[model samples]
Target: MKQKNKKNASLAKLTQQLLAIDDSLTGCMRCGLCQAVCPVYGVTLKEADVSRGKIALLENMAYEMLKDADGLSERLDRCLLCGSCQTNCPSGVNTIEIFLHARQLLAEYKGLSGVKKIIFRFILPHPKLMSFFVAVAGRLQRFFRRKANKNMGMFEFPLLRPFAGKRHFQPLAAKTFSAKYGKINTSAAKSGIKIAFFPGCVPDKLFVRVAEASLKVFEKHDVGVFMPDTMVCCGIPNLVSGDYTSFKRLVKINLDLLSQAEFDYLVSPCATCVSSIKENWFRFRKDFTDGERLQIEKIHDKTVDITEFLVDVLNVDFTQSANAGCTRRVTYHDSCHLKKTLGIFAQPRKILKNLSGLEFVEMPEADRCCGSGGSFTLTQHALANKIGQRKRNNAVSVKPDIVAAACPACMLQLMDMLSQNGDNVEVKHVVELYAEQLTVNS
Candidate 1:
């Protein structure tokens, strides 16, 4: 009887902490406006699937409709937390804050799993260890890889079938970008402009050629390059996982690495990393000391997505000289972190639209989320695929020669969906397309 009482007391305490987040959610106004913009709600139609509904469920625990703490954690993980709901909210409910608070509180209560603790708390923050794993995985990729889609540059792991499903993925690259070009410093060819490059982990590890293509464009345009060594993750994976400690650690590490560099701007081929540095870093800079905060602000001010840098800063003319109606038809997928979060839709399209020998076709709902919400896809693969298939259908409807997205993570999900569906569409980064069009000799 005493033990039972103790357990109930603990549950009550957790419930109270979870409910405290509701104070921040008071602005919700019970408005269903979130439903119109929510990607998960649009597909699931479950009340508990939308941000409004998730808030209500958390509210229910305060009122005692839910009692199982574990079940509540499961419910909370269902959301993409893409901030679309908050972006569309008329009352300005701040759904992202509420969800972040709830996730933090719940993660505090449940504690991260053993595997997750090791991955997020340890491996993710350590670049050297991460690079080692990437190298090993790259070497061992062929022994376990299964051919899933030939044209899409994807394969499936028959070994990881139980955990990864039968989903196809791009095979790990034999050499990482960082390994191929270590601490590179390139002088501007003739354009007399320079930028620091950050390819993030996936591109640096799995999509080395994408980074090469970006560098190719930079070289052809006479843009000087500053590629640094010993950079950490951009803190997106950490932030999304509710591990703010690790996230801040990575941010500080990256700031320390780039603090001594000289560059016009810090450009990356990744949309998520750019958005995180430009937006989220400044928002969370309060956690740092004033000196640290100012440094973060300086870095944030200079950060730009690669496409944005090309089209906006460099003023790369995408107007095809004579191949405006080129034979190759391609469609673009707007990454949620890129289009929805950063308002960087037009620049990538302009780069794509200007490509010679390529016909630009707009996929229906091109701005929709590609269901690759970083770690969200790993935890919630079924829902991720359901959402990704919607994106795949939109791409197929256009029947384009290829699908282009700015983020490599989005490329991963799109490859999985397109590969599984037997769709022949290829996936390429926007820079890859632009790089192909450049007259190298010019």
Candidate 2:
């Protein structure tokens, strides 16, 4: 009887803590406006899939008897963390912050899953181990990788087919961006802006060319480059998985590494990485040491998407040259982080619209989530594909020869959707498209 009372007391304590963490949700007002914007809710139509529904569940879990912890965690994980609900909320509820809070709280209560623990704890924090694994994976990729779509650059891992499902992905690169470039320290001859390059996970491993193109653009515009060696993965994957311990450790690693150097801005080809550094770093600021918090603030202020850098920082003249006569219809896909979070809409569009031989067409629902919420795509692929197919149809409806996005992750999803549908459209990073024009003009 005493032991039972002690257990109940502990459970009550945990529930109270969870409720305190989720108190930001009190602003929600049970508004159903989120249903119109939530990608998963649009597909599932389950009240449990939308933000209000999840908020109500969280409220219940905090106050009511403890029931299905696993079910609650799964419901929280159903979201893409895409910020659509927050963006659309008339009452201005911070749904992203609330959802992240719910995820962390529930994951703490239910405990991290086994597979996620290994990846988040052992694999992610060590850059050396991740690089070593990337090297080994790259070397062995050709053996397991079979071409699934040629133009789309997707492969099927037959050996890991059971784990990979029908999700076609670009094979790991033969060499990482760091391997090719090492660490570069170059001064601007004219542009005068110095940027520390963060070639995020996808660019570092799967799309080295995107990193290369970003470098090329910096050089062409006479912008300085700082490619630091000590960089690690941004903590988005860990944060999304609700593994705050790993997330904080990775943040410290990155903050320490970046503090060693000085630059005007930290530039990344990956919009998601920039968003994580800019917004999420601040969101989780309370968890850092005092000195680390200052560094996070300094670095956060300086992070910018590559598209924004080219047009805004370089002050690239976009008057549309007289000989800018040649044409191909290019539609731009707005990365949710870049668009909704940062309000970086016109800069990328201006970069695309200014391309000498390109005609920029706005795809319907251009700002829709590409369904690649980082790990969300890997875990919930069928639902992701369903959302991605909508994005794909919108891009193809414009009959664009090229679909451009500022995010590599979005590029991957767009490729999969377009390839699976046998569409002739090619998806590319907006920076890559801009880089192509720079090279031709040069």
The count of residue-pair clashes in candidate 2 stands at 0
Clashing pairs in 1: 328-359
The reply for model 2, stretches above 4 Å from the true place, is 1-16, 63-65, 320-323
List candidate 1 segments past 4 Å from native: 1-20, 60-66, 187-192, 320-325, 439-442
- TM-score to native of every candidate shown: 0.91, 0.94
Q: Cα RMSD to native, each candidate?
A: 3.8, 2.7
- On lDDT, the leading prediction is 2
**Tens digit of lDDT per residue, candidate 1, span 267-365?**
999988888888778878999988889988888878999999988999976674435657788899888778767888999888777677787889999
lDDT of 2 by residue, 1-442 (tens): 9999989998787767676756776888876988999889889889989988977877776543257777677677788999999999998998888878777766777789899899889998877788889999999888887888887777777776555457777788887888767778888667777888899989998888899899888888888888776588899998988788899998998887777667899999898999999999988898899999988888888888988887777777866542276578899999999899999999988888877888888999999898988877777778898999899989999889899988898988888888778676777888888788778778
Clashing pairs in 2: none
Candidate 2 has what TM-score?
0.94
Model 1, position 219: C-alpha lDDT score:
83
Q: In candidate 1, how many Å is residue 265 off? A: 1.2
Please provide the root mean square deviation of candidate 1 (C-alpha atoms, Å): 3.8
- The TM-score, computed over Cα atoms with residue i paired to residue i, of candidate 1 is 0.91
